[model samples]
Target: MKIRVLGSGHSGGTPMIGEGWGNADPKNPKNYRTRPSIVVENDKTRILVDTSPDLRVQLLAANIEHIDAVLYTHGHADHLNGIDDLRSVNRAMNEWIPAYTDAKTWSDIVNRFNYVLEPLKNDTNVFYKPCLKRNDITVGQQFEIGDFCIGVMDQDHGFMRTLGYRINQFAYSTDVVELPEESFKTLNGIDTWMVGALWEEPHITHAHVDKVINWAERVEPNRLILTHLSHRIDYETVSKRLPEFAELAYDGMILEL
Candidate 1:
């Protein structure tokens, strides 16, 4: 399996519109983040996780022309707002894509992009708007998406709950403040874990450095790649602070498992 970090920044991304890079160095390109998202692919399938607001740029940079499916972690704007960009993918494939998420996230997407969910009118072309087939998922359930046998668990995201997905030996868990015990069980024996660590300091809705390190110790993945970083966390500084087996994720980072 191959995992690509399409975007690694926090909700607002590094160097927020008005505010600029807080502690991250401007000279380091890795500090210039977009938003949180990833692509997991193998010989037979390519799955996108979260359609970040920077979806267009990220996909273009990654040169991804096709996607087998989309898995939504939650409904936060940073995660789901760029959903409209799926129209571009639809144009390329000339087919509606399948999207998997929990019931609440489906509701959120439906409420925000009802038009996209609507069947294409006879006069409308597939390229004119995003077309998606929704598949509702439940926590603790296991299902298959192409070549992947995925297991999902519930994560506490402060104001809401997010889904954490484990595909084979790799797992992606972002926008999480706390992981339920069952979630940890789902993550057990993973070889590589891509999880969120917002910054060095404690956060109300996201995981901090200490919390992430603690979880890493428990999960004991051979490789721990942290994502969803804020400008407050400097890549060089945090990289030095992490264990040898753990490191901060950057946009375009790829891992093969």
Candidate 2:
């Protein structure tokens, strides 16, 4: 299996519009992040984790043309806003994509893009808008998408709840601050864990550097890749602080398992 880091930055992404790279170096391309998203794929299937606001550019940069499924972590704008860009994929693939998410997240998505959730018209060739088949999932549920057998667990995002996904030995937990006991049990013994860590300091809604390290110590994954970074984190400086088993995720980084 291969996991591609489509975008690794926090909600605002690195080098915010009004505020430039906070602690990040301008010379390091690794600090030039977009939004949070990833693509998990094996030889037969490609599954997108989230449609980040930078999905278009991210997909282009990664040279990804088609995806079999989309799994949403939550309804945050950074994670869900770029959903409209999936229309281009719909047009290219000539089929409706299957998107999986919790009921509340689906509700938020429906409120925003109701049209995309509507049934496809009889004329399938008309790909003017995104056509998606909604598959409402629940915590602790297990499902299969192509070559993946996925397990879902509940995550606490402080203000709201999100879903973490486990597929084979690789698990993804983004936009989360607290992993419930059940979620940690689900993540136990994973080989690679790509989790969210906004910065070095403690955060109300997202996990920080120390917090993630603590979690990693418990789960003890062979490789721990931190994602959903903020401008407050400088690549070179933060890299030195992490243990040898852990590393910061950069845009376009690919991990083969």
Candidate 3:
């Protein structure tokens, strides 16, 4: 399987409009993050995780021509707000795309993007709008997209809950502050893990370096990559602090398993 980190920055992204680069160095390409998103693809399928607000540029830069499905971690603006960009993909493939999320998240999405949620019709014009089929997923239940089997686990994201997905030997957990006991069990044996870490300090709604490292210690994946990073976390500084098998993720980073 091949995993591509389309964007690794937190909600506002690095060099947030008007805020500049914060602690991140302006010269480092790794620090030029877009927003949090990733693409998982193998020979048979291509699945997107979260449509970052920077979706248009990210997809164009990645030269992604097709998407088999989209798995939403939550309905947060950072993750689901760029959903309308899927219309480009819809036009590319000339078909409706399936997006999976939990019931609450799906409900919010349907309510927010009522036009996109409309049922497809024989005379529907996909070019004029995105055609996405919302599939409500149950936590811990396994589902399929092409040849891969995916499982979702509940994650703690402040007052709201999000999802972490496990696909084969790799798992992705973003926008999470804590992993429930059941979530740990679900991620126990992954070979590669893409986990969310907001910064070096503790955060209320996002994982910090210390917390995620502790989880990595217990999960013991072959490689641990920290994503959903904030501008406060400098690439060089964080890279120096990470374990030999772990590192901070950057936009456009790709891992093959």
What C-alpha RMSD separates each model from the true structure? 0.9, 0.9, 1.2
Off by over 4 Å in 3: 120-122
lDDT of each: 0.94, 0.94, 0.92
lDDT of 1: 0.94
lDDT (Cα, tens digit) per residue for candidate 3, span 127-237: 678878878898999999998889999999998999999999999999899888999999978999999999998989999988998999999999999999988989998
Candidate 2, which segments miss by more than 4 Å at Cα? Answer: 121-124
* Candidate 1 least-lDDT 10 residues: 118-127
User: Model 1 segments beyond 4 Å from truth?
Assistant: 123-125
> For model 2, how does the per-residue alpha-carbon lDDT over 15-94 read when each residue is reduced to its tens digit?
98878899999899999999999999998999999999999999999988798999999999999999999999998888
Between candidates 1 and 3, the lDDT winner: 1
| Deviation (Å) of 189 in candidate 2 | 1.5
